[model samples]
Target: MASLRRVFATSILASVLSQVLTATAQPAFGVCYGMLGDNLPTPAAAIQLYKNHNIGTMQLYDPNPEALQALGNSGISVILGTKNEDLPNLASSVEAAKSWIDAHVLPYQGVNIKYIAVGDEVIPGESAQCVLPAMQNLQSAISGSSFSSVAMTTAVSGTVLGASYPPSSGAFTGDAKRALSGILQFLSNTHAPLLINVYPYFAYAADPSNIRLDYALFTAPGPVVRDGDLSYWNLLDAMVDAYYAAMERENFPNVGVVISESGWPSAGNGNFTTPQLALTYNRNFMKKIVAGTGTPKRPDSHLDGNIFAMFNEDLKSAGEEQNFGLFYPDGTPVYPIFS
Candidate 1:
């Protein structure tokens, strides 16, 4: 009897410890740490800002050595990127992919490298042809290394959706279908999520007359649109579900979707581009995700996303491109994110 009781006690203790670890290790909402600005803070200071704001995840456009070094032992999850220009080299040779990983990823000791995004919005052309091969090679390299826990994915734009209205009608068009199929197959095999950049701001600005500002801002008074049985109260949810539907149509309905980037520009040419609007949109977005309410199409799943930028990148093209940052280059908050 004492032996059975001991076993039971051990089992209960193990269960409790598992639950505690799961809760503590849950991924926090992330921000994109873009380094396009001339006056952005050093990576160490940037990590401090992230710590201040309770941001536990960060996405970088490239694996800069300094940034990777700063992230070490920081307890922050990182999603690193390989620039489009390097895809050809990585894809052409598995040795190159392994070498790149060794140089960029392996050295970052204790930094929780979650995902390696191969390229940003690469469509099926000469560059796009290299994406899948590079991803495959990278995945193999990571699997063989100490960082096998890291996953591989590519970020694509919402323009890949052929028909987005009504959400259920979503499907990939043209070269997107071919490119995405290979990606989806890879994701399915590895159980990695699809990273997509969903910009309701761009969608709204493109057709302001048709897209309601309140809906785009996630302050919809009521259901803005009903597609079949699913009712969408906000544009972000709809935009995400459109990708879900597209994936479903591709017969990979179970693959997860991660919004790699989404944010409203604080200043630009658009009538809706203002600090107040940006603040409203970002706050509302943060609240919705924190609430853990998934889209109507995937109500049981928590959607993981990263806000577009950490600072307004002055080096970007004129207008909205330079105004997505939540902070100034000097690490000053452009607006309060948490209140």
Candidate 2:
């Protein structure tokens, strides 16, 4: 009897130890390493930057040879973009789009080149008429190419969804529904992520009272607004759920939606939110994201989001928020996002 009791106690301790080790040994996470800054490090050095910091993935606005060669074999998946100017040309010629991919995308196959974004924020307006053509051309190019597994899609603005505040009320704008529905059909046919960019910062700025600061910052939630079993405990999930609803309305509800851009700016329009607060917002949220905390709606979905700009661009055209970087230009650590 004494021997059996001792054996049972040992088994219990071993099980407890196994659980603790499993929790501790979980991999850190991934992030988007953007190079929007003028004084940013060379692509080679930038590769080293994320490597040292333990970032796993990155997104490039364009598939620059410098960046591709640098990130090649670094084990980082690259998200390439189409410049707005190139849109008109790409739209006009499928051959040009194919050639562009051959030159820019083909070479990086085994090393990187995960997705080729058709263009950014195209919603078919007076300004966006030039973009959809590029999308059609790019899609054609991808279809003809051997690497269709490399996702061929575009990143759309969260604003495309008319009302995002309440997740259920989300839908595309009047005319946008037609354009967006087509885009969704393309995404559905081709297995690609939605790549939706959500900014809770805009929500907080627009109406601080109605929107909880903690919720917007993704800090900690109190008793949150519950809509049946579909409760939104915070802004991030709320924004994501809105995307889910939009996708559902299009009948491609199972389609993947990734957070293409989501982070807080340290300083901005009036600087009401403190630098520390900004750091807290980004650092904490990223930590949670990397820890595999999916939105309330999609618990099993990959929450591995790509945060905005890797380095803060000092010459960022305008406002301070436009800077939107994880690091300052001169290789100085703006804040310890992981620590």
Candidate 3:
């Protein structure tokens, strides 16, 4: 009897420990490492900063050679992007895609490349025509390589949605719908998630009259928007669900959605972009991702996403674009995000 009691106690303790470890492990949340700043740290130091904060993933805006080299054997997952200018060539021939992978990706065998974003916010424009072909060619190229497991996709802005007021009524704009039809189908067939840059800050900044700040910041006291049986407490989930609904409408319901970029600016806007609000939104966003919370539309889905940026970019367009970093150029935490 004594031996059985001891075994039971040990089992209980192990279970509790497992739960604690699971709760603390936040592999789903990541930060986008933007290199528009001339004063940013070296690739090695930037990688170290991510490690110091326990950020397990990174979203690189391009296949930066130095960043890739630094990421080797670092155990950090990466979402590598391709330059928009290269899209025409990548779409024109499969050989160009293979060459790109050979030049940029194959050299870094130790880097854990998760997704290869073909372009950033290029859809519904001239580059939109090149996106699908580039993705297809890249997919073919990747399939023949060791990094075949890497998902190939592109990131798009929330402006693609023509109707998103009610989550259920979400549908893509005519141009965006036309462009995404093939892309969405490809995503469904390949099991790759669509990378979306969902910025609630932009939405709120655009229309503060109807959109409450608490709803956008995930601090709503209760359900702010009731879409039938689904209640939205925050704008992030609503925006994400809108994309899901739009995809469902487009007949690609199985294709997943990954938020490639989302963050609040710390300055450059009056009364809207402040450090405290940025900290609150990011902290709450990280909590949601860490908890593996899903939206009401997809209750069982795990929300995998990257925060907008790692450090403020001085060279980006003036104003809020330059102020989205969680850290300053010197690698100090702008706010206690990891804390």
Candidate that would win on TM-score: 3
* Predicted candidate 3 versus true structure: per-residue lDDT over 1-339, tens digit per residue: 345334433544335433543567546789999999999999999999988777888999888899999999888999999999999999998899999999999999999999999999987898898999999998898886799899888999987899987999999999998899999988888899999999999999999999999999998999999999999999999999999999999888898999899999989998899877887788778778877889999989998988989999999999999999988899876655554
* Per-model TM values vs. the true structure: 0.91, 0.85, 0.92
Candidate 2 C-alpha lDDT tens digits along 1-339 = 345334433544335433433464333344556655667788888778877766666777877788888886787767788776677778788898888878887787655667777777766464365555666677777774566667777787776888765687667777667666767777777777777777888878888878878787765546476755777667888888888877787788868876777777766657644545566566656656656777777878767577776887766667656556767766665554433
Model 1, runs deviating above 4 Å: 1-27
Worst 10 residues of 1 by lDDT: 12-21
Task: Tell me the whole-model lDDT of each prediction, alpha carbons only.
Answer: 0.83, 0.69, 0.88
Question: Considering only N, C-alpha and C atoms within 3 Å, which residue pairs clash in candidate 3?
Answer: none
Clashes of each: 0, 0, 0
Give candidate 2 misplaced runs (Cα > 4 Å): 1-30, 33-35, 127-136, 139-146
The worst-scoring run of ten residues by lDDT in candidate 2 lies at 12-21
lDDT score for candidate 2 against the true structure: 0.69
